[model samples]
Target chain A: MEEDENIKKLNPVEMKLLTHIIKNEWKTLIRGKWVIGYGLIFLILTDTLLRFGGGGAEVLLSLSNVMLLFIPLVGMIYGILYIYQSREFVELLLTQPINRKTLFWGLFCGISTPLMAAFVVGAMLPLGWHGILAQDPGASVMVLALGGMLTLIFVALGFVLGLAFYEDRIKGFGFTIVIWLFMAILYDGLILMAIFTFGDYPLERFVIAATMLNPIDLARIMVLLEFDISALMGYTGAVFRQFFGTNSGILTASGMLVLWLAVPAWIGLRVFKKKDF
Target chain B: MNNYKPIQLHLFGGLILLLLAWTSVSEASASDTAADIVVSPDGPVVSIQEAVNMARPGDHIRVEAGVYVESNIMIDKKLTLEGIGYPEIDGNLEGHILIIAADSVTVSGFFLKNSGRSHVRDYAGIYIDKAKDVVIENNRLDNIFFGIYLSATERGVIRGNEIRSYERRESSSGNGIHLWNVKDPKILDNKVEGQRDGIYLEFAKGAEISGNRSNNNNRYGLHFMFSDDSVYRGNTFNKNGAGVAVMYSKNVDMIDNIFENNWGTSSYGLLLKDINDSRITGNRFYRNTVGIDSEGSNRVIVHRNDFELNGWAVNIKSSSRENQFTENNFIENSFDVRTDSPRNPNHFEGNYWSHYEGYDLNRDGIGDVPYRPVRLFSIIIQRQPESLILLRSMFITLLDTAERIMPVLTPATLIDEKPKMERIR
Candidate 1:
């Protein structure tokens, strides 16, 4: 029975209902103001701290990396947690003519817009306020492109988190925080301890793999190191120098961040497609 | 009469149509081509604010040479303010000259000075707040509290500016250039001096600080905290109270810089505190109290540098771990390396210790005997600090010799296994 349910084809009517559901989700996000406000405050504060706080560039960059996970996580909670509470809107959309796939993409795009806006505006601030483009226009462009991709990845993550617990808002919120905490802080701490314990021998190779797995680490390696993989080719950096310290490593890491966005989103769509309203 | 009437009517119609087309074209051109306003003797409005008022989007404002006494000049339009002959701008009582609220504005070639002092608030000369694509370059700032402040501003190039603050009595003052919540900033080739800190960064990302001179500051030449993933290269820091302090930051690369003459009772060429996963390579350190004093620093690689005439080459304090020091030259220093505690988690190898007295028996360029960098007197001085006054004394030399012979009083972990008998280069 489970296998049959898994293989069950969506009829035209169900597909249409799914499309309506996603469309309503998108509309709801566009009309909301929470994501914009959060992004605005974050950008303003980050800029202030960097410009006048007497801290150096490394501190600011690292801080920005930690903040990357929060925007999408919060956006997901706001988008998905309210689905059940949005009973009338969901019912009204279900009564329309659309498919689940359409609904998934529509909802994804709808909720992702504000997050994307926040990313663009936030990213643009560094380019202008710092005037990095005037010195190296090429680097500024590269940062912008990377910023755009990173924003999309985070926003898609929100969709997955949102869909995973549309049924239970509290559990979903808890799950998002856990995932963020694991990725941002706990995972690295555990990796460092492991390295210290077993790192008497040549064990940096394993540490490199573990660091690359974390999105925050990968993003940092890709951006801060830029294309100078040779600089990373030292004792501890040798492993990073060998892997993400190279051209192939940068490409692979970027591909990984993209996968992080796509896989979760696909899973969320699958769940949303089968979810009974 | 009939011929005249037809000709007159046709001519009148043609004239009317011509006039209509001419007016339409003029309006179209006027909407597209914005006005260029000059802020000097040539044009109206001697102050920067007046020029800002006259400017529309996509306009250029030229500022002439003269001391313009103003504060909080708002730039709300996309314009270029190119100063000729470096106009002196003094920010009296209120702070932050040329506050940019609009994007794509350029403030270049101005001698900015005398910003307002505030204990509670840090002020700036050219403050770009929440603006984008701003260029602040080739400007001279004197007695400025904070120069080229950035907040949430991106794609900025703070290049070729001479920023210097006077020696203020208060600790809160100084910082030649500052950045906060900033991203993708290129702070290149700027000379900063006489401030509490030459350059400071916080919560910024994707930044490159290169080819800058930071000297004669009361505090750190370059101070970084809680930041990550940044590159600093080809910068010279000299004669500061402390040279380059990096704290609570990670994934950083520092290369090809000279750290010199930062001498004090307690100071270093570079101070690494709670730093992790960083690379320090090809940097020269000379005539400083301590070269690279690291505390609670982890997972760092220090290699390929010249250390000359420093009081102590490297000082490793407590809780520093997993660091490797290699391929560095330690020449003419009173002490090569010293530590406070008896135990150390770091490893040192392949460094050329000039004070190594061991003979190379195997002809493999490596000394047969292990080189002890930390002397008993060095440890005692580290503990009592005041004992440093006895440096180079005959008594301390005898004590060091005794400790070297016995190897009991000095920390067992503070020895270099493969110290080079001769200099590599």
Candidate 2:
């Protein structure tokens, strides 16, 4: 009976934390006038202009490839920042006799609330627009799920970054930028250089392993290659085909992206639990 | 005695069961081989190669639109593998679509993935290793180790194929369409990207690499090393890794190609290293890091080409000699020429430079005043790249003008006399 009672109460801590986060998320969105106003305006203007730009819909779909990457990245940063900045609130909650783990989990949910809202809004645009343009439900869902996964990943990332540099926002932001650049440009550049200079020797296995490390590259290639094999039917396309052409490659990539989401969140939670702030 | 009795009974029962199971398993496997073969739109064979096994030569195997988990599909004979609605031939997480080790094979209209990518084994979607007369066309190769690999194979036509890769890690990736140690092949009108190179040739001789758009690739759009007597015409190589590098190759002609917008600090439109007796004529280079970058290249005739708005119109290192740049248009570029060697490795004659301000007094097409192509500011920037921020300033403009007037503080030997005032077109 005692064991049963403990089991029943085990999830209460998680529930309470989750509820607190959800409530805080609403508050942040209501107060986050600048982020909402600016970000929406920029997205709308760019999206509308792109719609008229011929092959804009496809390009939009392609650009939405970042949804999986940036959403997780940005959301993670924003969530961690919110929790880090609200140290006084966290301390007040700690004084209320709530468990430290519960408080951190609550903070996690609260920060993620804004990111979730933004994600839904961001995803809807692509879906609605794609529906209007191409009447493609499959494409729309793919795009939306892509966006959703991205948001979760980034929100988790934000948490990790925030927790990692709780005392230094500048350092955290700088590190994020460096990571973004590495994933976006530098990594690809380096990869190309290697492939070109070492064409004689076979190196496909290494390329596949390298691709598993970057979430953005993984999502972009997965979506693109899944939709149209022709999209990557090039030099590097061959490498992609070799790795992701099978259920195994897809599974591995998906597994890696999932890890990218889970590991960061886990780390952030660990940090949030131990940190004085 | 008591322990032995229980053990003997257990062993006797186990032996009998094992014999029974072995016979049943063999029968089941034998039956499965015959009944496991399926053909349908949705509940079709789990793999294309499995479908291939059920198919005879000249059989039209129609595959549906879904993901099939398979790998190392060996097509040993001639067949038509067609996807009804682009059924994905997945290499079962890590598999190759159709590795054709035999000749006279034709693969078309299916999404081929996972072509046996090994640093050791040359895996390809339609790999013709030492096979001949293969026709691979109209197939979309995605994320393959190699789109269509032909090694030591001859008389194959790879046309209307789109091979691409997004995994841009250097040392361990494959090319779009790789032809190694092959001779007399025709590769035409393929759009390949995201690979090491779009169309790569290693020791591939007497082949025509024409009418292909290879862009956004990790390496060169078209790369040929030690591949000689080949013709690359009407190819567009844009935004690739180092553009197109043809090294240790001879008697090659690169004509009517657009090598442009390949702007990396160390990239070039066309990099010819240690190439001998090559003809680069009627080629257009626009907005590349260095158009026609030649190092240790000799006896090359470059004429009637447009080198417009590149970072450096012509980059000839000291090792290059007796190469000619004639009737080429150099317009609105930062540097007309760049070289480490003190002496002129190549001659520049009758080329149009946008900065050329000279009169044709004799009414000849060539300008009367000699045009010094190298600017002193460019030299300064070469030595100290940070000084590029001073570009287009009054000081830089004045310094360049002075350098052009006197030829001092600039490489005097790097002058293009008889500079045409207009484009050769």
Candidate 3:
């Protein structure tokens, strides 16, 4: 109840200005060709994968692997770059009688929604055209959903970075790439290192906890659930299966992903609200 | 003295008289034809025991279509027990259904079931002891402790038997086809399921096991120890509890076999332990926990085998040495090779590994750069098994890449120097 009062709802004027800003942002971003270009990249990736990858299951695996590595980087870079590129427009809006919440959410939605659509549609077209959806509709839908979640989560992350370092472009770009590298590479490396270093301990619970810490690993494990053949996973895979528990596992992962999305966008909005343009 | 003696005396006297006449008649018609002893449900001699008691050495005892509830049906003469219409032989859970104690015996075309389970004795559907030139074929065995137990048998052929059991525990069940101290026992075209071991060989030499489907057993599909010069080919062992294990065996030729889907904490498609001079060729190990776990195994040649989607294609323990893996296609396995030791003495050459990303220059079929199958992360997994949860992690990929460029932690000698550009058929 206290939290409900803490959330400030927009007045009618703020809502009108918010919708206007969202419409204009969408127009500029769509007309800029970056969104369509980002989409075409996924089209080419999925098309090549479907053409050369051997079986139906194999193509889906390849697509997920590529998606896991590429989606976050693309999403974050797009979000940060868009925020920094429209600096003049954002500052000019700051001069008007506008609420910060209106501008922040409008920009966030405008940047994230199209990129999510681009990734999903780009990947889905090749698979549907090749009739891979008929072979394994469940796994295909899962890959697209995971891809969409990653895009939204990373875009929110990118917004926080953009708003935090708008004045300093070099630091902003540097920190953005560093964050991507940490999530994509260093986080997993540290997990492996910890596993090897503490080899003598009972590490099952530790490993699962570690996997939950990283969004990428969490996403990958979710994909692993879809292709959870008992043989390929061996004994270790069995432990993962027991813990994941199919439906509950997906629920927990999706919940975590939602949390990941909400926290970052909330922080980015907070930064936008107080930052002096 | 006994014009009205006990029925035992009457039966004994009648059997002696019949055997004397039958032996004399069989000697006269010896080479041309063996005599026929028909045991029908409504005949003068209805029981198979009564017919065998009245027959000569080389007679054919034809059992007509009926259920026989007798146990310990002993065949002590060199004769044939042929079932006319797959007559049921129920042991009533008492003892062995058929005990062939004589040489040159043939038992075929029967449905044998419900042998007695004892902690002391191995009650089987058909028990052959010290027999030579015996053939037990075309029989269906169900709910048996042991399906076909052959001990000290020479030149026996056990073929086309469908053996199924329902015992879930290994201690209560016996092997489907047990060969102990046997020579040249050709096990052919049998389907054995849900037993301790599908085909077990202990001290069985020069045995030929082929064309069998053994799946979902309590323990191993094929478990052999100290069996030398045996050939296992054209067999499918799937989803067994521990898969196949060949221990302390030499000159083992395993060709064209499919070992699939056996996943457990310490299971493998084939576990070669303390064996020497074996050839694993043209065998497909698919989706097993470990395709071939070699420990103390030496001088084995693994050629042209397809290891597909297994957890580990080949896991070589520190004690295994001098094994050659060549021309094999390692496709999409979670880990191509894992070794406990960093100093690998076994050779991996000319194999096509899906993980090999080296380029083939000079238009040759082989890659210019040698491909190392063991990654640093696999070594980490060897030490820490729980780290396998981090499989396909990007961090592990980077570590593997850096470790591949500079030989560190992983065995440098474990390189496939002449890696094939394409998969070997």
Winning candidate number (lDDT): 3
Q: Which residue ranges in model 1 land beyond 4 Å of their true spot?
A: A1-277, B1-35, B383-386
- lDDT for model 2 comes to 0.71
Instruction: Identify the leading candidate in terms of TM-score.
Output: 3
Candidate 2 residue-wise lDDT, B98-152, digit = tens: 7776667766667777666678765666677787778777888888877788889
Give Cα distance to truth, residue A145, candidate 2, Å: 42
lDDT of 3 by residue, B1-425 (tens): 66657887889999999999999986774443543777777876688888888888998888888988878988899999998899898999989989999999998999999999999999999999999999998999999999999989999899999999999998999999999999999999999999999999999999999999999999999999999999999999999999999999899999999999887777899999999999999999987889999999999999999998787889999799899999998887778898888688898999988778888878688999999999887777667777777777787777789999998788878899999877676
The TM-score ranking, best first, is 3, 1, 2
Q: In the order shown, what is each candidate's alpha-carbon RMSD?
A: 27.2, 21.9, 7.6
lDDT of each: 0.72, 0.71, 0.86
lDDT by residue for model 1 (B1-425), tens:
68699889999999999999998975664553343555675445788898888777887777888878998899987888888899888887577776888888888899888887778777788888888888888999887777778888887888899998776553866688788888888999999988888889988787899999998888889998777998999999998886789888899999999998876555679999999999999999876777889999998999998887676788887689989998898875657787877887888898887657688878898988888888886666444332332333334555678888898978887778898866656
Residue range A184-242, candidate 3, lDDT tens digits: 88888787778778877777778887878778888987876665343324655455657
Model 2, A54-152: lDDT tens digits are 233333443454464355456656665675677777777777866655666566656665556565565467446645335546555555566666666
Clashes of 3: 0
What is the overall TM-score of model 1 with all chains considered together? 0.56
Q: Candidate 2 regions off by >4 Å?
A: A1-277, B1-39, B42-47, B54-66, B114-122
Clashes of 2: 46
Residue-level error in angstroms, candidate 3, position B71: 2.6
The DockQ for candidate 1, computed on C-alphas, is 0.01
Alpha-carbon lDDT of model 3? 0.86
